[model samples]
Target: MSQQDRIPCFLLAAGRGERMRPLTDDLPKPLLKIQNKSLLEWHLGALRKAGIQDVVINHAWLGEKIEHALGNGSQFGLHIQYSPEGTALETAGGIAKALPLLKPEDYFMVINGDVFSPNLPINNILAKVAIFRAASNKPLAHLLMVPNPVQHPEGDFFLEDSQISALNLGAGEKLTFSGIGLYHKDLFKDLAIGVPAKLAPLLIAAMEQNKVSGEKYVGPWHDVGTPQRLQELNAAYE
Candidate 1:
């Protein structure tokens, strides 16, 4: 598929960032700066480079600041839209709420706005989406898995030969979810709009049926959940 035909993407920015404390006390976590640019800006630049045009950002806390900073996304060569929530809905809830804006495509990409991944393998994931849709056993989601960070040592899921499962399946390597995924619209069909729901339950349910897929990404990736990590990221870039 051509770049223009690539799927739309959603940047999940609605979280309250309670972990970031005083920093998030004023600005939304996605708006936090790394290498002098906002976290969301980095993702937007990467998305544009990956040939994605339409973008949706969901925000709750200090959402106006996000709108003010990015505006219509013209500067970054993207057409941006916002899905504002009265309160921060969990992952699946936010995606469900933004479905209308993302309905143009059968599958859409979602990335946690707070995470910092310089090379997210967007094209590779898109290629996987095409393969998934063609298979008889259509998967509801394709996730990007990374090495578990110190903060999350147990990790989240296991991958064996491209098939992801909640179980270890004996010896497959376990990895932490990178907070980035390509999801089919049908995945959220049963979810009620504006309802608070965590994404893990949905993913785990699909995993039990062998309906979720994943790939390991061994490149630079960071969750950036704390002030120290933020400073560390900035220093690394410098």
Candidate 2:
């Protein structure tokens, strides 16, 4: 697959940023700057580098700031759309609400807006989607699993042989869900649009059926959850 091949993606931007406090009291967390650049901008820049042409961003808390900051993403060389959840619809609900706008043929990419990963492997992910699409049974989702972060050491799911399971398989590595994944529309099929729903329950259900697959990504990725974490990232950039 080449740059010309267009695959739409949506960034999970709809969140309250409750943890970021006073800084986020005025600005959405994703708008918080790292080296004077908003977190969402990094995702956009990387997506542009990966040749993704279309994008969607969902926002709830102070969402207009997000829109004003990024505009239609023309500056990033990509057409952007927004899914304004009157309130943060958690994850699956936000995706479900945006489903109409996405209408992904098979799978579409989603990345947590809070995570600061300037070098997102979009092409590699698309390649994996190709393989998943060609397999005997298409997985409902493909996740990018990163080593357990200090904030979340227990990890979220188990990865054994490229397959993600909610249950511990005894030998598989239990890693963190990098908040990056390619999901089939069907994964949110039962969810009603506008109703708040979390992605974990849906993913857990899918994992039970062995419908989720993932791969380890030992790269520069960080969950900018706390102000200290953001400060550390900026300090490192300096």
Candidate 3:
């Protein structure tokens, strides 16, 4: 398949960034800067380099600023569309609602707005998810994992033999979610569109069927959620 035919994607930027507090009280997390550029811009530029042409960004808090800033994505050489959220719909539900904007590919990509990870391997991640989808009758989602970073030392999920298991259950070491993943649309078929939903439950559900795949990334990455972490990230680039 051609690059465009492989799959299209959406950037998950609609969160209110409640944890970041006063910093995000006025600006959305995706609009915050590191090395003089917004997190969204870095991801867009990276996605463009990986040959993705179309992008859909959903936003709520201070969302207009995102539109005003990235306007149509021409600056980054990608076609852009917006799904303005009157109220944030969390992660899975946000993707569910934006289904119409996505192409009829086997799967699509999602990256959390508050993160700054190394250039992602979008094609490889999709390849792995396709392998899962072929073996299971149900939908599949492939998550990228990174070694537990400082802020979330407890970590979030666990991996064994390329399959991911949720941390809420039995004994297993936790690995950070890495804010990067690929999801087949069928994963959200049972969800009500435009409703609030987190990706955790769905991830666990996929884990039960042994349908979720993951890879641990030992590269440059950071969850730039707070002002302190953002400052550290900026300093490293300088």
Candidate 4:
């Protein structure tokens, strides 16, 4: 496929952002402002800059606000579509429900609504997907990792030879999930439609098969999980 044809779109603005409480009590986490713009706006702006034209955003809590904020996406010069969930479906469920909106491509990208990261290279993600598809017999899902934050330093997974795995908890090195990833729909091929589920077990299943790939992002990344961290992030950027 041509490079342009190889570009995959994304899933955005879906999570409950529970950790970002109080602030999220009145507004969805994606609407939280930083430098006078909502976090979702920041992501949309970046996606626009990266030449991505199609996007899928799912929402539950205060979802209409999202539609109000980004109607039709023409304002952003993109074709944005909404997959409204009356109740927040956890990550996997949301993705499973939104699959029809995605193209029948090799893989698609997913980004957490609450994460803050420096501009990522979309081409880099496409490259990873291609490499994994060519190399392994297993299905491909490339996750991005970041260094553990002080608040939860134990972190989520360990990386060995471009793969992600659960820690031994006794002799494990810690690295945090960056909340950005490339996923092929085949990862959910066997999932029953409209069912609610989390991505943890699915991810662990992929890891067990050695199908998961990862890269450490040493660039700027913030969890922005609470009012305090939101304030801290806002102050840092100021």
Candidate 5:
């Protein structure tokens, strides 16, 4: 794909994975295996299938191992770049630090490297990029909302006719942020590079202004946060 047509993707893999304990003691969570392939590998394959050639992965804990494992991504038909953080920057901070590599685009796709969503609807999101760009309000982000998993029963935000809002407003059903999204670079303009910040506050701020849009995805999605869940997925995949 041409440069303009190529939507750069940033994979957020820098978390400490404190909950994963000994499994994460030596290996970063993204490198954890599922069905004989690394979790990050699954994302790489999916992105490549969606025609996303340019990818940036941020890593902190056991970051070098990730670099060693993926190399230049040639094997996967992708151009992979690393944004190494001294410490695991929260989601927003990691993306902000990687902005230089992802620049020259009004928006880009970001996915949480730790999660697994085999059918992420990347093509649909790319199709909406043009629509979002031309919108009068110029929304800064478009999120993928999924049915709330048992782990997060309260859910995160409510979606009404594709417009996302922080308040339920007694409207559409509340869903969980799937950690898969299309984000405008302008959303992080105010953040200082290298400093840590969470993405939720930024998303919430935009939601209040009606500057965020989202769609509900009912698909096989898994947040492999704990070793038990990982084992369960491995068994199911087996």
Candidate 6:
């Protein structure tokens, strides 16, 4: 991608992490480590490798720690910006808050700060961006789905013919959202700036209009939500 077309990325890190308790009480979840590397750093390394230079990280609880840890992102080979929501806005709201900082691109990548997916493919994401850029009818959102882990066996959405649809009365093999996605800015444009909002409703609304698409990603992905899950991931990844 040319410098003129280099798409920016938004890192979703503003969650209060209620599930991850005391560990998050002192540190924002995104700053937590897996195999000695902070989650945000792992993501930064991959994003930089993917040739995405600009990243906006939104944080609420102990937000300053994230800024202190990563600084201006010079060490990560990228320019960084922070969206410090004083109180954690839910997913969509956080992205909406950072939209301006994401540059003027119509599309930007969004990744969940807490998920551990070190092997997410960079080239695949770039290819999808290319496809979206050239499509006559670009999807409002495209997600990378994963086979449901034991903890979330029922899963989130069903993937059929490269389109993502909500479970139809609980039928079909459901896949877990990898929490990594490419989204058209229009998807979140209507969300109120400061109100807390979840992303599911927005994506579901888009899916109802055949505006969302996705692919299954079979990779090492973990949603490190609980202390046990975190411990298991540390031992397993170690």
State the local distance difference test value for candidate 2: 0.89
Assess each prediction's global lDDT (C-alpha) against the native.
Answer: 0.91, 0.89, 0.82, 0.79, 0.92, 0.88
lDDT of 1 by residue, 71-182 (tens): 9999999999999999888999999999998764678899999999887788888787668767998999999999999999999999899889988897789999999998
Best of the candidates, TM-score: 5
Question: What is the lDDT for 58 in model 4?
Answer: 87
**Which residue pairs collide in model 5, if any?**
none
Which residue pairs show collisions in model 3?
none
Cand. 5 TM to true fold: 0.97
Could you report the Cα RMSD, in angstroms, for every candidate shown?
Answer: 1.5, 1.7, 2.3, 2.4, 1.0, 1.7
Model 5 segments more than 4 A misplaced: none
Q: Kindly list the per-residue Cα lDDT of model 4 for residues 126-201, writing each as its tens digit.
A: 6666565567574557888888998878898988767688755244456888888888788888777677778889
Residues 65-178, candidate 6, lDDT per residue (tens digit)?
Answer: 999999999999999999999887889999898998987467788999999898878668767877887888889999999999998898999988788899653444589999
TM-score of each: 0.97, 0.96, 0.90, 0.91, 0.97, 0.95
Cα miss at 13, model 3 (Å)?
1.0
lDDT at residue 154 of model 2 (Cα atoms)? 96
- Single out the weakest 10-residue window by summed lDDT for candidate 2: 1-10
- Per-residue lDDT tens digits for candidate 2, residues 154-190, read 9988999999998887678999999999998899999
Q: Rank the candidates by lDDT, best first.
A: 5, 1, 2, 6, 3, 4
Best by lDDT: 5
Give the clashing pairs for model 1: none
Q: What's model 1's TM-score?
A: 0.97
